[model samples]
Target: MTDSTATRATKPFRFGVVAPLTTDLPTWRDRVRRIAGSGYSTLLMPDVPKWQPAPAPTLAAAAGLADLRVGTWVYASPLRPAWSTAWEAHSLSVLTDGRFEMGIGTGRPGIEDELRELGLPVTRPGERLAQVRETVTRLRELDGPDLHTPVVMAVRGPKARALAAEFADTVTFALMPGDDRAEMTRLVRDFRTDRDVELSQHVAVVGDSVAPFMASPDTDPAALRAADSLAVLPDDPAAAAEEIQRRREEIGFSYFVFGADFAEKLAPVVAELAGH
Candidate 1:
């Protein structure tokens, strides 16, 4: 089975889309079919209640649809018990034939409504990060000693970033349009560990339309380009290659994710950066 170690050793500068389940089954199936051959390395969906479909079923559907790797953009650790969350993740890992990469994090702000709905406590960052620690440990145990389930830790703080460095195969940061190279370098430095961990940047690629859905509302594609945050090119393959080089040399980001708006537009960039 492909584990975290193997993934980090082999996977190159990869690209993925966090496609939302905003449409009906037939339409979603057609979209999935298109994305399966779009040169993306992974197919991920966010676990925001009511904002997107239930993560497990949606990810399982993606697994059934194609050979592309599947995972949650991240499931909030505090939302479900470690065992239950691990059970679902474990089942998906098996179902997807080791194509599952479990991305998890402490629940974000404004999760109080969801917590209230789920009868979960709205704990502080420390307790939530502890939940993340327990969750990753349980997932590994659930996957068994022989088969390691690749894990991704999405975090931004020192303590949570520490959890990611220790337990994850990849770590994703929600960078803003105004964030400079120095800040990004600092974040990578903070997230670095002796173990291999691919650093991922979730950038909003603008083509058809900017995804209003983003970690930060300020991630508008036009605004980002204006602010010098947009590095990869969607139309020019050479420019895309240049962006890939810059990412690797400047800050060591090997994985990049975009919203569904870039699904079709990201093809050229993905084709250019898929293997290299």
Candidate 2:
């Protein structure tokens, strides 16, 4: 391992919860407060349109209700123009008093179909990556020299990883339900060989329950365990904390993001490990 990767485990640990507004305003505010009170560092909203409210306004509301940071689980680049996305991100950063982290990516799987449905151009992979780049560039320009809004990038392919290495403050290796753990470790190791950015992993399952929208509803916990998937965590707080530390030591992952449904389940682990 390179020197940077070797020392990666020494990075402080922080936790985030991905939550969308699925209830009344009061209920959502309560959830946001509870998440902050539970020792979470950030509250994130997914970029899915129609199925949920827009991420910007929701995140603004969330940030207002709690002292915790706020961000997008990831903004899909193809959803809107780069300037528009960057403008909203810059506004959020300013409104939140620099507490907003911009999480962005080309888009999720099958984004082509979504684009087609919305009558937006269905660009190729390279074009989508360009969009991400443009959005980040525009965001930087808008933020000016006085402020730097942190960027969190969720990446999967080599090209995306390269772009993330260039611009991301935090990087998340987008994992599928059954992706090989060894390969992921190698990828992360390679990514960290020269840079010391914070590494985040999205936890889809805590114990036997899979968080909604994180994975298929029928996703089998036994199957994931048998495959040694990194997307699942133990239910017991002590066990979960142990595994999280092991992951940081072995794979250089120090930041963990959990879906809202199981954020409470992992709060104990968060309470024990956050800021450590």
Candidate 3:
């Protein structure tokens, strides 16, 4: 058997879709099929309130349709018990036959409101990250038929990134080429002792006009500073397609996760890269 470490290190180049939770299943399925047909192999469904489906049931509903791998973009670590999340993820892995990848992070902003609405307590982030670590460790210990998935950590800060390298199969971040990008990569590499751990990266793309539409002159300097190599491409679909492809290659992520609306436009771009 290939060592788990080697297997992770050697996983193939992947293209994945980030399915927003609120999208209808029929729409999502159609998208997934198109994505699979377009040569992408993975799907990253976000676990936020509006994005989350009934995990196992939703996954089951989409099961066996295409040659695609699927997993959570992230589940809110601070909101639920480590044991509960661990078991839930494990069960999903079993149901999906090892196609699941777990992305976890400290709860996001406004989580308090969401939890209260769902009748849950709102806790602090540091405590939740710690709890999540313990739960992930325990889940990693399970073997045999109960096991099939790999847990990943999505972190931005240095300390959390280091911790993820030590425990998770993959350590990922929302990276756009900037001081933070260089710093994040450096931290991950410095702390990552094993060749086995995978580094997953995220990048956002927008047409050249997007700079005007999405970014304001007063947007936080820290956020803007974080997006250094962030490109401003032409508004035309073809030009946007080319620009997205270029950005993906420049970023060097193991997977390229395209937004839903960009799927059709990104098809030729993805094909161009694959051919290379």
Candidate 4:
């Protein structure tokens, strides 16, 4: 199916910045305010433990300081009990006055090692998917009837996609570097065949710089450009805007996320295309 046939083409464009707080409190507050002032719709935090502050408290702080939405650029489901995760997500939704989105997934690649390191159970893929489902289910129960917290799911395999179809308000593909653009197109088309959930693309690199935790430190921009990876975007504002429009038109990707490092540089593109 072509983009014209896809349901997400009608969705307005929006951008999100995945910025982990790596600075002092005052500096971080300034960065959050700056991102809000820019045209980005959401301020997202990574879920990696020990790398930065916890997502909940930090996200709450960001929400207090900015007018934009806040979210976990995805919570790793295997780290905590489903109820605990759900309760935290629901609290964020309430604390942010419904401006919080719960972006979650089974976990990143090789998360089992991390779980083992943390002394958490290393669950199988199916079990991890079950954990994700339970978390969403309990979150809905906690949210009650009046509040429906938005769910953004990062999916890779068929099972995860099926689960996402059942519960997600937004879905982002868990794509790796050098993955084929055509394959991603097919996935988006297939997922949107009978569903109109929002489609999000996680951009790892803008120009020559790779965002922290988004990709390997040694990631080569030249190689990504040569391979035409979707994880990278052109640095020039016009070129980036053009590529973003093309992605939305052809692959049904209307929500683009970038690392916080390039949020300022990409603000112009956000200004030109956001909510359009």
The most accurate candidate by lDDT is 4
lDDT of 4 at 193: 34
Per-residue lDDT tens digits of candidate 3, residues 1-276?
A: 222333343344455566554567688788778887887656666666544565545655555667667777677786678888888777777777787777788755557888888887677767767877877876776535556477778776656765676777776664433445455435434444444665554434444222211123343444443454332334465765565554434433455555556567666666656434
TM-score per candidate: 0.87, 0.96, 0.74, 0.96
- Candidate 4 residue-wise lDDT, 56-165, digit = tens: 99999999998999999899999999999999999999999999999999888889889989999899999989999999999999999999999999998888988888
lDDT of 2 by residue, 116-174 (tens): 99999999989999999999999999999998999999998889988988889899998
Distance from true location, Cα of 202 in model 1, Å: 0.6
Ranking by lDDT: 4, 2, 1, 3
Candidate 1 ranges with C-alpha deviation above 4 Å? 1-11, 117-119, 176-178, 216-223, 230-238
Better of 3 and 4 by lDDT: 4
Clashing pairs in 2: none
lDDT of 1 by residue, 1-276 (tens): 223332345347888788878888898887877787988888888878778778888898888988899988888888888888888888888888889988888766667778988777888778888888888888888888767788888887778776777888888875655766667677766565667778787766553245645555544556655556643234455565677668776677778887776677667777877778
lDDT of 4 at 216: 77
Candidate 2 regions off by >4 Å? 1-4, 7-9
Off by over 4 Å in 3: 1-12, 21-24, 50-52, 144-148, 175-191, 208-252, 274-276
| Ranked candidates, highest TM-score first | 4, 2, 1, 3
